[model samples]
Target: MERFVLTDAQWARIEPHCLGKASDPGRSGRDNRLFLEAVLWIVRTGSPWRDLPSMFGNWSTAYRRFNDWRRADVFKRIFDAVSDEPDMEYAMVDATIVKVHRHGQGAKGGLKARP
Candidate 1:
């Protein structure tokens, strides 16, 4: 019901590739969608795993999944897939006016200014 919550249809499509086949027999709910959903929630919100909703699963489970995915380069794989799509392209360079930080303004009042 949350704004960023992934829909069942979306999960069905991504599950095959991301999670692969189901777990072995007698596997508890521990090896199911709850952990997967928790990981997705943490990533979508850009929040700490400890803050994951109880409905999704334990925070520890989510954190493990995130670290596992990172170590396995799963996120990079997903990005690569999306980037290969025909609709993705282009670059835009922008020069925006903004005040420079004091450290970035190098010797403006010194010999540098005279040149």
Candidate 2:
């Protein structure tokens, strides 16, 4: 009954790449889709791990699992699978989300210092 971020189809595509499947030999994840949703929740909200809601279970547990997956490169494979073809039809950079380097910002006499 949790609000989920991934559509059924998107979860379908990413599910196979997830670890701890029933078919795997080790301990199975309580719920792969749920775990994914929890991770996505962190990403979308930019919230600290300690602030992760109770619906997603323990924050520390999720953090540990996330790091485990990261070390195993599981996310990379999932990203590769799902992003096989990126849609560049409307790619644009927005200043609000973009960061300027200190040097680019005249920190140490940038353009103004130039001849």
Candidate 3:
């Protein structure tokens, strides 16, 4: 499977928020960027952890790392860091569009008579 790529600028922005940096205590992560990409792949494709590609290493390890980061709120930190300056110039919402399910149309009898 094709993997995602982060430009130098993009990496620079998120690097500080990532876990297992050289400055972090304990054993450093093997490759934080690759690990993140693995997580992204699972999220984007909505695939189970068992389906993770071999290129990203063991699926169990990736899932464990994802859980560790999630429990630490690392993902929120990264989103906050990168979304500091969002471009809302073209943001929009279509309130006119609505979906009505078949069952929601109502039963044939508007009201049933009392027995």
Tell me, what's the RMSD of every candidate?
4.9, 3.8, 3.6
User: What's the residue-level lDDT of 8 in candidate 3?
Assistant: 67
Residue-by-residue lDDT tens digits, candidate 1, 1-115: 3543556755554554454345524323444355566666666899887788877767886677667667868667656644554553465445555657767987555455555
TM-score for all predictions?
A: 0.56, 0.79, 0.79
Summarize candidate 3's per-residue lDDT along 1-115 as a digit string, tens digits.
3545766687799999999999999867899989988888888999999999899999999898898999999999999988899899767766555656657777574457876
- Alpha-carbon lDDT of model 2: 0.88
Ranking by lDDT: 2, 3, 1
Model 1 score (lDDT): 0.61
Query: Alpha carbon lDDT of residue 33, candidate 2?
Result: 88
Residue 97 lDDT in candidate 2: 66
Compared with the true structure, what per-residue lDDT tens digits does model 2 show for residues 1-115?
4567888888889999999998988877898888888888899999999999898899999999999899999999999988988898779899976987776776556366658
RMSD of 1: 4.9
Question: Which residue runs of candidate 1 sit more than 4 Å off their true CA positions?
Answer: 1-4, 7-13, 23-37, 86-93, 97-109, 112-115
Q: How many residue pairs clash in each candidate?
A: 0, 0, 0
Q: Report the lDDT of model 1 for residue 82.
A: 45
In candidate 2, position 26 carries an lDDT of 83
